[model samples]
Target: MQPGADDPWSAPVATGPVRATVTVPGSKSGTNRALVLAAAADGVSRLRGALRSRDTVLMAAALRELGATVTEESGPGADQGDAEIVVTGPVGAARGTATIDCGNAGTVARFTPALATLARGDVRFDGDPRMRDRPLTPLLRALRELGAHIDGDRMPFTVRGTGAVPGGAVTVDASDSSQLVSGLLLAAARFERGATVTHAGHRLPSGPYLDMTVADLRAAGVVVDVDDPTADLLRAGATPAASTRRWRVEPGGPRPLDRVIEPDLNSAAAFVAAAAVTGGEVTITGWPAATEQPGRMLPDLLVAMGCRAELVPDGLRVTGGGRITGIDVDLSDFGEAAPVLTGLAVLADSPSRLRGIAHLRLQETDRLAALAGELGRLGARVTVTDDGLAITPVPLHGARLDPHADHRLAMTYAVVGLAVPGVTVDDIATTGKTVPDFARMWATMLAG
Candidate 1:
């Protein structure tokens, strides 16, 4: 069951080294992407090691509602809440109105509405009131340019489909959300002309996330052309003719989910932060040596914060010494890692600056505002920036932190509570959006 807004959890402040080996569940990113890709694929695709959290469940449920067949089975892993889901592809809905509930997941809000364009009937979308506010204009514009008859520009909108889209060149200023680009690219292969998506604004934030989408798309047999300001920045002097801020997906179908999905590294980051807070060692088993998941950047962020990180045979091991230092870093490529850093910054011995997270304001909540307010209530001097936060280290005391219906905010509250006394985090149940059994998992990590 989902936790209510008023249920506050007493945070357990750690008094010693938090030694534990935790195996987190599957990636919400991977699971949701797989669900969308499988629904576009030609045959039955089984997603092993999938997360069944509120976010991914919402994705699966939306796909199921749109005529795709999704079945869940017991997961083959250490975590019991995990599951193996089987999805049947592109079940056609020739007629009818389908309503999709996106909850607060960015993936669902942006991705599913485009996928609905493949249907023959009208697909209406709405979610939590906050979901209604997240940016959908770019995606809607791109869809309309591709021949989709969409009504209303945001949530509570409708996608009137004629069973096919004449996909072609469309430009979008997707500076506010990377999901806007990813959602379109994921389902572009189904379009008659495929798609050529060009970003008309500044360089894309969270480049790794876009890389993940392209990698997944190409792995599933879609042909994509990589031409972005950042990609050009990476490959200099060799490809002068390459187009910047553009991605072209060849019209075709994708493959099934034929392999096991990796664990949610971002979710595992909270446990890693626990080690940092208590000056203990945390070794997450089955850590992929390399990947595009944003959480893979945690080691560098931790090291910058004065924690010791090393790659061990079992997994990545992070050890926190007594003192935690503040840092100045740009988190544009990996914004998901910001909250963990924010939690540590409050306990640091110096000032910290986290920049390039302006996109966060469009997330599950206005993250910058939420951080500024909650951390202020906890007695920290926080300056909310245009893109990030400037936090000054100060002695913190216990206080109530309102999570504003955001999972990351609530999770960060728990981390702050690990060092400060008498911290109560409201809307504790919101953590269910990603981390399964968050309280129990946190307890187990602290028990060691």
Candidate 2:
């Protein structure tokens, strides 16, 4: 049985030095986008090297609900071989409708509605209760403006696809999640006259993820035009008349493809933090130097915090000795790393302030609150605001931690427990949503 959100974790046991090569999982964002594109494509689209994490699995299941044929097969390589998900074109009733369960995945919840526009029937989208509570008003308003019939119920809302979405300018507030914007862009190609999008207030957080969406659309045979004057404005070309098209997903692990996903820098962050706090040396293998993911800035940030981190051919080598320093840095690009960095901040010599993370509140959990609240339980002074968080370096004492059923929070606190004795985390199972083998991998690194 799955553990409840309120459960408290066991105290952390002593963990020794960590020295081993670790292969991170594929990007959840990339796999989810590929699954959606494959479903919208005209021919049998094959996705290679796809991630099989909970989020990706939910996307696959959602596509299956939409009447796509998805297959999984092992690849013939050192890394997990290719997962051959074959998407048969949109074969369901032109007006067919289905209720999709997005589980706890924010990516699926946001992306699924846009895909519904191609269907001829009413698509009722539902998810875990927490997901329903997360705001969808911005995306809903944008879709309605584009002529989509959206009923605004919390979880049991119904979206009726008219196959006639207007291709004109629509402004979207993407401060919550960039997935909403990506979803609209994904469906833009299918519109009769194409579409234009403008970001309303502050620039969308995780802009790189949106850029990835645009790049993926182009790779899948969709044309997009960006207005130079305004960074937020974008124009998409009409869906290609040719329904049948073929594209190859590049393989991972030391590949030189232009757009292949680099190893998950976010996942590597936990181990990196572990090494830093324990005064140990751990090298994260498979990270590319030119990657755009915000987590890729770990080495530089760690260096700024007085840790020695070098980028190697394989991955990153981090060594810890000197006292950690407080940093006041804008994290608009690497918002996902904020939680782990917050944990590090608790051990720093001075107070640390992380800014530009207002978007974090809308993630899988209210990450800002979760971080501040849960870390406070471990005897740290953390203050959370609407925009970001401030941590006054306090001598951390080990205590039970509540992960709030968030994978990143669970893993971040778990690493924190390694340094601060007696720390335990509740609902560690949630880590499987992203890193299924987190326990085993962590054990292996400790064993080395």
Candidate 3:
């Protein structure tokens, strides 16, 4: 049977040790961004290794709604092999009134609206109830300054574009989510005046995402102010010799670059966490030596918790030495990994403190609270602070773990099930939002 089958709940017992090398799919972050950029670009872009998960599908559908032609090329082996997404942009075409369903995807909810601002006429966007709770005021306010008409601050909003966005200078505090910044940056090059963005809020959470956006923008041949400091003389795309907290994208337009997307490193973390907890070894193929994906930092975190992490021809091998020691990691730069870290922390021999990720509160669910509550149901003791989680190595028993319709949280509980017996995960289907084959892959990874 295919993954995410008939059973809505998955409770796979770890029979003996987990030893397998899993090949995860493309990065959801990268795939969604590529989809948006391809749609916003002036020419057609082909995305090789694009992920086909619920989240990315929402992104693709949203782009299609905005009048882009998204073709998923299929052949004899395309279903099981690497597939490609060919996006024919509707640039300057009649991207008339359309409706977008974000479907619990923050990227689609936050990123696509900016792209819609480039299209003409009305574009209305709505999503799952949870999306309504997610933050969008900053992005909306920023888009408003860029001369787009928005109906509201949150989900179920409308963007009225007059065939062009008179983009110049706008500032938004990207401290909560970097999508607001990255989304605007992705479409900035297509703006009539280009776009200049500055962060007016506290330090941007997940600074790497900002860098990733700028890197992609530059790679697409958009002019970026390498350093937009107030003292430096500005270029043609300049708003002002701005503060260090600013980013600018020149108005020349976006260039479509043919590039293969990287595997979702965060998805790979699930297999790594399995190896970490079961005192076994798991290899992830094609692990990059250098990349911008936040999952790149997992090897370092694994090494800190009594695991042997090494890069070999086989892949990035993480050998769980049958013991997990307490790890104190400040995961500020990569909050996406926090759920995986939390699962490992509970099974450690000592207490682990994960600091500097309070921004996780604004994620799909109140991540810290949801993680604490779910693990607590499994007879684990965890304390939730304002910013992070403090987990003690309390022997955990099995219980039903609700996924809260969040894919990452669902996968995190699956990791715990590798060591603990009878850890039933409800709504395992929720993992389809990112890892569509999450359960089937887990079952295969556990095959003895």
Candidate 4:
């Protein structure tokens, strides 16, 4: 059984170099995206190796509420919780009243609502108390602009679907979260006139996730034309400021998918990071040669921090030197990895500046403030920067870390604990939001 939220877990410290091979579950982002696309597809879509976690489970449930059938059965030779998800789709216009509990999952809160607009009756969306603060206004307003009738400006809102949406052009400021953009694009192909989205924000973080959304849509046979303004701006020697990174999706039925979900590289990074911290080696099995997931940059990031990373036939292997060197970097495309990277940076030889992540302030928790407070509590000099963080290495000690209900924070502190003894994490089970059995996985990696 998983630990409860109130449970305090003593994070295990490494006795020697950690040498192990770790395999992670399916991608939360990919699974949820596949669920949405499957619900919109023409026929049955089968997803093998889908992750069973709070977020993905909530996503499947939300789709079911929208008149789609999502079933799960254990796959042959699959790990615990690994299942083949069968989604019978092209949810019709007869879908009646439905209520979606987003449960603080950003993908559910953002992506599910777009699918709700295609329903024929009232669809109410609500989530955990923390979900009320996440950015939904942009997506909601974009839906409204595309002929969707929404009752409120935020969560606990009602989507008064009229059985059809006259999707057309709409401009959105999605700097706060890329999910807003992905949510719109995912449901656009079903719109009567298709859909066109233009980003007018000052900055667009997590640009790679948008690529993932577009790629998934293409895999489903949706025609998407992306107009990136950066190339033109660079040709003119002008810095791009997000004038309009537009995407146009033509109205059509997405082809049913039969694909295997890839391993979640974001969550897998912690194990590879264990190697970096303990001066050991770790191999992450089933590492894809290419992926739209932003975590694909892990090898480059590790190499920048004085670690050696190689892609082997089976997976990606990382070997850490006894010493870690700091470097300056911008994590706009992969800010979700910031917390764990910050933990690694605390042990670096020089100061580290992580920039382009101000939007983290509005995620599961105010990540910037939480990381600053929690890391500072452990005797590290962490200053919350405007767009990211600045960390200076100092002698550290173990302390009970409060993740403030954020799973990333819990994992980040746990990584720090592998080096700093006596460290404890409040609500280590919060990692279940993504990694269903994080505690066991960490222990197994260390035991090897």
TM-score for candidate 2 = 0.87
Better of 3 and 4 by TM-score: 4
- Put down candidate 2 lDDT per residue, 358-423, tens digits, no spaces: 988877889999999989988899999768999998777888887877889988887787778888
Candidate 1 deviant stretches above 4 angstroms? 1-4, 77-80, 229-244
Tens digits of per-residue lDDT for model 4, 228-301: 88657978899875656899999997889999999889988788889889999999999999999999988999
Model 1: ten consecutive residues of lowest lDDT = 235-244
The model with the greater TM-score, 1 or 2, is: 1
lDDT at residue 12 of model 4 (Cα atoms): 95
| Cα misplacement distance, residue 401 of candidate 4 (Å) | 0.8
TM-scores for all predictions: 0.96, 0.87, 0.93, 0.98
Q: Candidate 1 lDDT (Cα, whole model)? A: 0.86
Tens digit per residue, CA lDDT, model 1, 50-155:
8888888889888877788889888766353589899998846833788888988889998887788887788888999988888898899889999999999888
TM-score of model number 4: 0.98
Quick one: RMSD of model 4? 1.3
Error of 2 at 107 (Å): 1.1
Q: Order the candidates by TM-score, highest first.
A: 4, 1, 3, 2
Q: Compared with the true structure, what per-residue lDDT tens digits does model 3 show for residues 340-447?
A: 888888989999999888888888888999999999998888889878999998878989888787888999998888788888887787877777757778888888
Worst 10 residues of 3 by lDDT: 74-83
